[model samples]
Target: MTSSLPLLLLALCSLSAAEAQLTVFNLRASDLPSGIVVTTDGYVKVFCGSASLGETSVRNNDPNPWWEEKFTYFQGQENDVLRLEVHDSDIFFNDLLGVCQRQINFMREHDCFLESGGLLHYSYTLNGNNQ
Candidate 1:
């Protein structure tokens, strides 16, 4: 077992180095419900598996908000699902606006919008393998 230990270690290291890139762009929403005449701070949380790639800044008081924020993350497996959750930020607790999910393989160069209670438009694209 010891004789093959070095080769096994090398293979594992190379596997970890194999990576892909995920880009999220042009997130905007309109026709949102104005609640109680209060400012709605809308933001998004993006996740691939358990790893969070962070979120966009809150757009205060704008029901029709455009967040052209771009984010990059270490891509998961091709079949893994990417989850996006939109929320309204509040002082005490935040309200969930919507939830969306898409497979990583289908995200590339495709428009992914989640509109149930509100309107949201965004796109995801994948870059070549990064090693």
Candidate 2:
């Protein structure tokens, strides 16, 4: 609506114009709960706010699975929170394994977050978040 233009402008004005990039290097899980008959097929998905960055391929049969996949997201803001979810892929329904979340601006150059059932390893170049 026309009434929202000024507010939008204000919000945009508050945002830093410099570029930023976040790189998720990999994710790994250990001791994932296995179904009675089968081992877990685990995967991971990442999000910046409500926007999905990408997901990893399922690694089958191993509770200690490492996905050395990389994902890059650009133009991050100060308030953006990075979220990662671990899941067990199943035939009927996927099970939620764990979740990790942290503010993008508060992260170090290289850090790991201990999720409920896993760990997310990531790094970011947050030159723009200084504003």
Candidate 3:
């Protein structure tokens, strides 16, 4: 009985640990239009426009090159923030003439701009109501 008591206590502890779980709520531009809002209990809500929705992969210059090393990995139950990307149409020109004339100048001045690879990254907190 004494030997079994320790095993039983260990099992109960593991079960309790499993109950305090962390979950992720991922949102993208494709999920909804500009007016829609998403909520998470312990995380910040992110909104990305349609132009930024598509397949997302690890960023080229990401410090972690592994497939699972992106922002999504950091999501947890408590104290999390969501990330979002939106399109800047004024800066991106569709025509070559516009690109040569205005877009180039904008790019040079800004030094960096968001690209439309068709993906939006977002994270949300998980709580009883939002989960």
Candidate 4:
């Protein structure tokens, strides 16, 4: 029927190009307006290019901090872009509290992605995809 619908839409675009499972949950930061206090234990750094898939565990003097991070990737494509950086845990200098990105096919077609900086709120979860 209609040439088998172009081979079933190329087998559903090759099963939506598989490989996924990116969970970073409950990472919070609320009610802010206190600047110029650099060095108060804070962490969150996840990148998916040049490989540095790890971070989070430095929450002292927390400003609504709660990092439940998890990451896994296996040949992730669709212009992979999941880079988040929010740091304040400094011994000499490490204060960068802003940065967000999302483009693993738009987090696997809106499976998950809620990124924010400055009063942080970054929760991205896309479990199951491959491309």
Candidate number achieving the greatest TM-score relative to the actual structure:
1
State the lDDT of candidate 2 residue by residue for 1-131, as single tens digits.
Answer: 35998989888876646556766664666677787899989888888888888999999998878887877777566768888888889989998877778887665543344444445455555544554
Best by lDDT: 1
RMSD of each: 4.4, 6.8, 17.1, 10.8
Candidate 3: stretches off by over 4 Å: 19-26, 30-75, 78-131
Q: Per-prediction count of colliding residue pairs?
A: 0, 0, 3, 6
The runs of at least 3 residues in candidate 1 whose Cα sits more than 4 Å from the true structure, single-residue gaps closed, are 1-17, 107-116
Provide the lowest-lDDT 10-residue window in model 2.
Answer: 109-118
What is the C-alpha lDDT profile of model 4 across 23-78, one tens digit per residue? 55556555322357632467778787667788888787765667776666555555
> Weakest 10 consecutive residues, lDDT, candidate 4?
108-117
- Residue pairs with clashing backbones, model 3: 43-125, 53-118, 54-118
Q: Tell me the whole-model lDDT of each prediction, alpha carbons only.
A: 0.74, 0.73, 0.26, 0.62
Q: Give a tens-digit lDDT track for model 3, residues 34-121.
A: 2123211111122221121122342222221112222222123233322343322222431110010111111111111224222333
Considering summed lDDT, which 10 consecutive residues are worst modelled in model 1?
A: 107-116
* lDDT for predicted candidate 4 compared with the true structure: 0.62
Candidate 3 whole-model C-alpha lDDT, 0 to 1: 0.26
What is the full ranking by lDDT, best candidate first?
A: 1, 2, 4, 3
* Stretches of model 2 off by over 4 angstroms after superposition: 1-16, 109-131
